[model samples]
Target: MKKFIHEDFLLETDYAKELYHDYAKGQPIIDYHSHLPPNELAEDKNFENITQIWIEGDHYKWRAMRALGVPEKFITGKATDAEKFQKWAQTVPYTMRNPLYHWTHLELSRYFGIDELLTPESAEDIYAQCNSHLKKPSFSTRNLVSKMNVEVVCTTDDPLDNLSHHITLAESDCPVKVLPTFRPDGLINIEKVDFTDYISTLSKITGITITDLASLGEAAKKRVAYFHENGCRLSDHGLIHAYGYDYTEAEINKILSNRFAEKSISEKEIRQYKSAVLHLLGQLYAEKNWVMQLHLGPIRDTNKAILTKIGINAGVDSIGDYPQAEQLANFLNRLNNSGSLPKTILYNSNPSDNELFATMAGNFTGEEIKGKVQFGAAWWFLDQKDGIKDQLDAVSNMGLLSCSVGMLTDSRSFLSFPRHEYYRRVLCNILGNDLKDGLLPHDMKWIGKIVQDITYNNAKEFFQFPSLVENLSLKR
Candidate 1:
């Protein structure tokens, strides 16, 4: 048998190997979406050890360790960093057939030059070696980003954030362009307990009293402009599903007013309010030429006790089973009718919606742009091997795969850049396998260009990030 995760790992044929090594590997990453904290990059923070960087804030590993019967102490509790690393190494072998197994070794090899598999016996030496490297200036957050050949990073940010870190990076001669993405989930989900308080915070920031939907729209527009001034080119929304409920202006105004008055609104009213706000934001996105991303189908924080203790996004979330097609299509059509549909990307956390989303993406392609409306890469719970293949198949069957922009880490970890590499390998393998089976021609030059486009070029062209748009044109 072949060696584990060799240079041609996942590549089963000659075409696959060459496609990855020659065309896909050296391309710079445009990490258009991630949760990497800007302050860490701005301060150029260095981790104290492997666990600090790899274990902390990574819910993927937490979920796996929890599955292996690991206690909270070693996962996210008061254990020492070394203790956490030991627990993780012990859990690694059990992760075979899971994406984490590949990601773990890929990161170790790419970032730390460690080739041996992680296990309980090797944990101590590996931890010590990583800790020693962490102390070096080259391992600082900014340097780590540079080392990955990342061209741009768009960090998800709330509308109320001051974006001081983005400004700081812009002023420095930082190698990568670190920009902000406007994520207004708090503002959109008006039924949350913290909704009024979040609005109050936005009111304080914008000097606009958000007593009605109109004022809320005004406040959001102001923040959008602020984000644009700070070089933001994208906005993201996370929802159970897209909203399309129709509500009159008076009805929406009353909903917001009652919400601010500490009155209870029904679930239907909640959806109505959310739909109205999203449509308003879509108009703003179109006007500002910002790309809008919708991440749908998550039933979050299901374990109430764990949620009560560790809070949301503690890896207690699961895919939601929502009826996505009708509402999603309705929302897009509404935006299209109003000429307020910006360049859009739809991501489905539930695999059942993959074909639906891929088919729907074609219904809204803009005349001014190629692949103006896209089905985004597999996300969150669906970022694994089967999920990736399913999404690619759906998009290829129903949409323009050649014009599709590619993957993002969608992660909170710096080591997550290897995920992009993983996606590239999977993509090349799919294309190469077809060629080897006589389903595709052996036109290496054309196939190679398509791989490069998906790896880096499409995102560079799709987002038209100001820092790199000129370069994109030159490269083309």
Candidate 2:
């Protein structure tokens, strides 16, 4: 049998094949947002086996394995790495029509040069082969990034994180620009039991005694400044919906004082506090010219039992049915009215909000900026082929697709870089089909340039990272 993933994989037409090969295939990736650990890149850590690098911290694979009746021991438990690989291989063939099947084979082919379908039958050989490759110096984390032609990768970071690893990467000879993105969900989530503890930690970090809302904002601003100096150009927030509740500065201060005193806070008070903090941070991000990314609509940690056992982000989350439009508009309008709305990217986990997010993004475009408020790439559960097509259609129909920044991994695994290629193929196929049907002009050069822009150039210009721009200039 021919390889499932070949040169023409996912390219259905001659135009599709031509566009992908000529315009999209060789473009360098700019993963402007992801959950990749910076310390691994800073240390150039090499995995001892494929499972260590691929299975660990990958909740997608773990979720699939659990669906196939694999026990936690094999998924994230005391099973040996070899056993986990066996369980994953056993689960692979059953994942047909799912994105994992394609991702698994693509990673195997792209990284290990092994195109054989992963199965219980072929598991041993493939596992051994991947392990052998892992032992090579070229398979180290930094080399893997270079192998994928990644120009820049911005890792999500906590506001209180020291970012010493990011500092190390910046000062080292590492080719890829690994920058940090400020993620202050902890600060925004005041309803959590450990909120005061997190505030205390932040106070210690900034040497600002957190006694009131003003001091809290002062400490947050200091951290934002520190992150900007350390090459951070983005801030990310994870929320079920936008917090746009109305409240005065006095009300927010009272709420913070109550929380600090270990007193009960009403739901209205919680929303008010969150809105105040988010609004304050939005202005600060604008001051520093940093992009703010809002990842919305996921109801996280639903399975209380599993969460208690595995902690958070163990794949128990699902797309939430939140009323996003009104609050989202209110928040953005408030920022825009204040003239402090930074360049923002809105990502929706629920597909029902596709056109809503697309049109909403179009609401706040800057005269000098192209697609300033962006409907970000299909995210989380929506990063698959069908979800990608739907998001692209929404952007093309409701907004400017050509001006939009393209795909990002948003993944923790180094091997997930082929997701960009997967997205590119889908993109070329869409445009190529339009050309074949006479829906678009037959000018390949013009369309090809647009494809190249969406694949690479758009993000480079949209983000405008100093080090990334300088490095790409040197290469030119």
Candidate lDDT (C-alpha), each? 0.91, 0.93
Candidate 2 residue pairs in backbone clash: none
Candidate 1: regions farther than 4 A off: 1-3, 468-476
Q: Which candidate is the best by lDDT?
A: 2
**Cand. 2 Cα-lDDT:** 0.93
User: Which residues of candidate 2, in runs, are more than 4 Å off?
Assistant: 469-476
TM-score of 2: 0.98
**How close is every model to the real structure, measured as TM-score?**
0.97, 0.98
lDDT of 1: 0.91
Model 2, span 186-219: residue lDDT tens: 9999999999999999999999999877998899
Q: How close to the true structure is residue 215 of candidate 2, measured as C-alpha lDDT?
A: 93
